[model samples]
Target: MHSPEIDNMAKLWDLIGDIRLAMFTTRHHNGHLHSRPMTTQNSRADHDTKLWFFMSRHGSPVAELTGEASVNVAYANPGKDTYVSVSGNATVVDDVAKKRQLWSKSAEAWFPGGPTDPDLALVRVDITHAHFWDVHENKLVQLFEMGKAAVTGHPAPKLGRQGEVRMA
Candidate 1:
């Protein structure tokens, strides 16, 4: 039998495994939330509690992470009706080996100087909690369910699997 923790982690991974980009949100010094699209660097890995990204040291995200470690990364695959939101603490890691390991030729477009570039920054987010929604049925079925619930004056039928996983 699988532990509940393992099941939760597996479910979380199943929701986000194929999504490459996420909206990484952080709080700025002025007390405002900011979000930006970031390509996930470690999604293919088996690790369930950490997410990685390559960024510019001079960017606002790096500065924000320095000020406040709390952050949220959201992943959505509308085609598959899957969405995930992950909360974590973010930190800038100054590990060259890790940078090299996650490095890709496509990254050169942003950091022209490659992994050894002084401006390149590696950010790691230690996931604390994750919430996910995955709809297994087709759109037509979902619409039918909603319509039926509305006509019956009952709560909408559960159209998907939704759960939360605490990792910290």
Candidate 2:
């Protein structure tokens, strides 16, 4: 469980845990942002404030991050009105042990040769900052708030809790 006073990374983990797919964005050589869906591998954020993903050694994500480490990963749970965006530096790790630790049978679908697959790449994103919005209120209440704000000509009322975490 996560509490208000819990470590921000843990709070981030709470928002994203069940939202398994994230739009992992990275910069391309031409300076445009590129994004692709990647599976979230961990059940919780570790104290080190890192997020992990497995990629193919031949994949663009591995090559792009190698050339430019900056990246953003976005997770959204529309049903829960929870969204999280993480900004970080990414590096392709060469640790076999770490790869083995994070590996799963599902991953074999991508890297058919298992953990020892020569094409399997382990990526570690060292979180520098994160922002999240979690709306616990029901849709009816949210609609009412927006309506009231529009009638009053004021900014939309805050829909729910918003927070930022800086780890760098």
Residue-pair clashes per prediction, in order, are 0, 0
- For model 2, residues 1-168, the per-residue Cα lDDT tens digits are 664435776677777778879999999988899999998676443445888898989989998997899999999999999999999999988889888878888898999998889999889999888999899899999999899888999988677899897776
| TM-scores for every predicted model | 0.93, 0.90
- Candidate 1 residues 17-119, lDDT tens each? 7887999999999999999999888836645778889999999999998899999999999999999999999999999998888888888899999999999
Candidate 1 ranges beyond 4 A from true positions: 1-3
State, as a TM-score between 0 and 1, how close model 2 is to the true structure: 0.90
Q: Model 2's lDDT to the true fold?
A: 0.86
Give candidate 2 misplaced runs (Cα > 4 Å).
Answer: 1-6, 44-48
| lDDT of candidates 1 onward, in order | 0.90, 0.86
Best by lDDT: 1
Q: Which candidate's TM-score is highest?
A: 1
